[model samples]
Target: MSKLFTPYVIRGLEIKNRIWVSPMCQYSSQEGMPTDWHFVHLGSRAVGGAGLVMVEASAVSPEGRISPDDSGIWTDAQATAFQRITGFIRAQGAVAAIQLAHAGRKASTAVPWKGGATLSTREGGWIPWAPSAIPFTDGDPLPHEMSLDDTRTVIRQFEEAAQRSLAAGFQVIEIHMAHGYLLHEFLSPLSNRRQDEYGGSFENRIRLPLQVARAVRELWPEELPLFVRISASDWKAGGWDVEQSVLLARELSAIGVDLIDCSSGGLVADAKITAGPAYQVPFADKIRREAGIATAAVGIITEPHQAEEILQSQKADAIFMAREFLRDPYWPMHAASALHAEIGWPKQYERARR
Candidate 1:
């Protein structure tokens, strides 16, 4: 079998292939609950032969949502709703995972396709919380600076969410520490300007994120894996950079994080990102080597050979694709054919396999 089709075992869970679906938000939830839309959207990718199917950035609290329609696991009802989708994914021989997220200063905005403007409280928005009260940009609303109590509560919320995710049958739990979300806000000095133990120096900035990761790891079963997505670089001068990411990854590994899902930018609005095919693979490669941890390479990794070469070069343990998966749900099966590797088709779709 090709490296891309090789089974990857992390801890006690074995993922059937290196091709995993990156969580792309559909923004189609109802009051944070997964509807049938989620079931079909996620299940299709599983049927398409992804090794892992991850739910999008789910809010740990209502205010943590990027918009009113973002998926969440803050309630028992939402967890129950996810059961059907997880069952379908597992049945298709794919590992079911969920990305737990808190948007922080990036929250309370309209969905991307809907202009993405900041929504007022009357417009079904709430005040967003962050490490600092800074607005993402000059025109963005100033987020409320989190108090010590708020910080502790948010950590507890992540622990509770992990418990709920376990009950929902997800085998992996990925913490969203990337893309300028709440945790990223704390990690980047440009966004985190607080004067407490949760801010200032690198150690202080990483305090809350570490706490949150430890909390989740504590609740998450040791037999499963815990992943943390991180913006390897803010792509701006004096911001979160690769060196910091290496140190962070090392620290996370010490806390029992299984892998670092490497991506870039999103800490600031105007930072220039020179994105291209496999642009972010270097981050994963560097982290995996220097930090001595497994890493998932994401962003612009589309072609079959491209993914194969990434694994063959040991750049990353797995390839996470978002837009490519959205465009072709069966990219994995297609990749298998292109790479001349054998992969099984769903029994119902066997007739359609060439």
Candidate 2:
């Protein structure tokens, strides 16, 4: 049997299989609330047969949203809305997870279908803020640097978000600390030029994310699992790299983080992504071995054999796919069939199982 389909335990949480649905921004929320689009989008994956179906990067606060339409759990009302979705995922036997994030310098953009440009207030978008006043690219407007008070508020927001997530019945809480978003902007040298405590050295760069993680960990139930998504490589010189990622992973694991979802790039516009099948798998292997922590491999990992090799090589504790799942919601069942792994199909689709 492919180890990729094997059960793995983290803390007290037992994941039925190794396949995970990587959090892909739905960009379909209404005022940070999960719409029916999110329900079907996420529920289908659980029905498709992944062990863990993580929700998209949910903004912890209004300003943390990647776009005006991104999902959120900042309030009890929002949490209540998510309860239905998580309930559905659980019924299908997949662990429900959420990726809590603050977009930082990457916030206030239009949805990709709407041109992905910085949104103006006139067009229903808010200004982006971060650890420093940096623009993501040459064409993007400058973002307001967050004050010390703002930093504290951000941490509180994450705490509240975590509480809400638990209330909504999410089993795994993943702090989104990577991909050139808020937390990553503080970590990457190219974006964070601050001389303050949140910039300059690695300690300063990782401080806020660490605080956020700790806050979330404290709020989260001990029996549940926690994960942190990190851009293992910024894909540029003098920016966040594998060594720094390993260092951060070790620290996170010590603080009860269950997995490091290893993804790369999105630090800056100048980054040249050398995309290929399993391009970012190396980062997962490095972090898992070097840091002695579990890691989730993401990127162009589409095929069953490719996903199997990652587990066989001890690269990642789980296989996560975004685009592949987007293309085929039944990717998990197909992979199970192709790999000859003995995972059963959803009872509703039993007749269609190969």
Candidate 3:
């Protein structure tokens, strides 16, 4: 039997297979509400046979979004809108998941296809928040240094969003602590240089993210598994690295995080990332072994045998694909065929199944 096609159980959640769909931002929301675009986009993956279909980095509040068009779970209406999408995913025999995120200094930016520049207030942008009063890039607007009240508010926002995610029928909640977002800004010294309880030293730096995790954990159902995605390395000198990621994973696991989705290098613009196939797999492998926690390997993982090798060697419990899934939502179904594994295809598409 192909290990990649085997069921993997986490807590009370049993995924049908080891291939999970990574959260990819569509930048297609209006007033934080996902439209038909999101429903069809996410629904297709579930129909395509992924074990889990995760929504993109959804902001916990208006100011937390990466762009004005980013998704959010801050309102009851938004949560209600997600019900149909999540229901569709579950109906397709795939677990529906959502990533709760705050962009921090990276907020108030234009979407990638539209130049991806930091937007000014004149352009319908608001001041971004961060652990320190620093900009992601030198010329970008400086973010507001988060006050103690701001920290508490964000933690509360995560708890509230978790409740909303539950109401929306999402079975999994992945905390977005990666991609140089708010939580990540606090973890990396390169971005967080404040002299407070939530910054400076490593313990202090990790304080906020851990608090958010604990708060969300308290609100979420005990049966559902919680995941946290982290950029294992900042890819720059004197920044957040794998060692810190291992410690972070251990701490998160202690507080009920079921899996660490390991991806690397989104902390800076010119951090000299050495990108290649499975370049980030070692981070997942090391963290899983050292922290005694489950990990999901991501980053340029596109082939069946490569994914099979990662799972079979105990490098990672599962593999998450973003671009490949975008290229072909039926990747898991195709992968089963490529690996010669007898996995089920959607009954509606059985005639097309070879």
Give TM per candidate.
0.99, 0.98, 0.99
lDDT of 3 by residue, 169-280 (tens): 9999999999999999999999999898988889999999999999999888999999999999999999999999999999999999999999988889889998999999
Off by over 4 Å in 3: none
Residue lDDT tens for model 2, 1-354: 779789989889888999999999989998899999989999999999999999999999998998999999898889999999999999999999999999998998889998998887788877898777778877777788999899999999999999999899999999998889998888788888888898899999888889989988987888998999999998899889999999999999888888899999998888988989899999999999999998999999889999999899888889889999999998888888889888978887789765
Error of 3 at 297 (Å): 0.1
Clashing pairs in 1: none
lDDT of each: 0.96, 0.90, 0.95
Q: Quick one: RMSD of model 1?
A: 0.7
Per-candidate clashes come to: 0, 0, 0
Model 1 lDDT on a 0 to 1 scale: 0.96
Estimate the TM-score for candidate 3: 0.99
Candidate 2 overall lDDT versus native? 0.90
Residue 92 in model 3: lDDT: 94
Highest lDDT scorer: 1
Task: Tell me the tens digit of each residue's lDDT in model 1 across 1-354.
Answer: 599999999999999999999998999999899999999989999999999999999999999999999999999999999999999999999999999999999999999999999998998899999999899879777899999999999999999999999999999999999999999999999999999999999999999999999999988999999999999999999899999999999999999999999999999999999999999999999999999999999999999999999999999999999999999999999999999999899999999878
